[model samples]
Target: MDVLLERKSVRNYTNEDVKQEDLEYILRAAMSAPTARNTRCYSFLVIKNKETHKKIAQIHRAAQMILEAPLAILVVGDEDKAYEKYLPQDCAAATQNILLAATAKGYGSVWCGIYSNEERAKAIEKLFDLPTNIKAFSIVVIGKSTDNRPPKNGWDPEKTKYEKWK
Candidate 1:
C-alpha cells in the first residue's frame, strides 16, 4: 500500500547510473506477474545506449523521457507464446509490477506505451532488429529522480459500483 501510494511517474532524472543488481531485482518482479493460462508472453529488452535512447525518443513525443533517463526497459509481448487476446493484458500486468518494484527500490520510472501505435511499434522493431514473432508493448524509463513530487490520492469512491449500474 505504501509503495502504491508513493508511486509517481518520474520523467526528469539525475545523472546517477542504475546498478545492475537493482535492475535484476526489477526484472524479477516483472517476471513474477501473473499471466493468462500461465503463458508468459513477455520479453524484456534493456537499453542503456545513448544513441538508442535518442532514436526511441524520436519515435514518440511522450517517450522523450527515455533520453533523460539512464536506461529504458522495453517490454515486448510475444504473440506466438500466448493468445492474441491476452498478450496485452499479460504485458500490462508485468509493466505494473516493474513500476511498483522500481519505486520500492528508490528508482524513478515512467511507462511509455508502444504496442497500440503501429508506426511506433514498427520503428522500434526495426531499430532493435526484433524478430517478427515479438512486438514491443511498452518501455519503462528508469533512473534517479531529479526532484521528488508529493503523491496524490487516486481513490475515487464515486467511480465504483457496488453490484450493478445505478
Candidate 2:
C-alpha cells in the first residue's frame, strides 16, 4: 500500500544506469500482470543506447525526459498473441506493473503513451523496424531520480460512483 501511494511519475533523473538484475525483476513484474483469456500479448524492448533514447524523445514530445534517464523500456502489443481487442488493456496492466515494480525497487519512472497516436506510433514502428504484427504501446523511462516531489493523493470522491452511473 505504501508503495502504491509512493509511486509517483518521476521525470528528472540522474545518469546512473539501472542494473541488469533490476531490469529483469521489473520485466518479471510486467509479465506477471493479468491478461485477457490468458493471452499475454505484450513484448518489451529495452533501450539502453543514448542514440535510441534521443530518437524516441524526438518521436514523443512528452518523452524529452527520456534523454536524461539511463534506460527506457518500450512496451509493445503483438496482435498475433492478443485476444480480440484486449491488447490495449493487457498492455496497460503490464505497463502499470512495470511502474509499480520500478517504484518498489527504489527507482524513478515515467510512462509515455504511444499506442493510439497514429503518427507517433508509426514513427516508433519505423524507428524500431517492428513487425506488422507488433504495435507500439508505451515507453517507461527509468533511472535514479533527481526530483524530490512528493506523491499526490489522487483519490477524488467526485470521480467515484457506486454500482451505477447515476
| C-alpha lDDT (0 to 100) for residue 164 of candidate 2 | 97
lDDT of 1 by residue, 79-126 (tens): 899775899999999999999999999989999999999989999999
Question: Each candidate: what lDDT?
Answer: 0.91, 0.95
The clash count of every prediction, one per candidate, is: 0, 0
Q: Quick one: best lDDT, which candidate?
A: 2
> Cα lDDT for residue 48, model 2?
94
lDDT of 2 by residue, 62-102 (tens): 99999999999999999998999999999999999999999
* Model 2 / residue 149 / CA error / Å: 0.8
Candidate 1 accuracy as TM-score: 0.96
TM-score of each: 0.96, 0.96
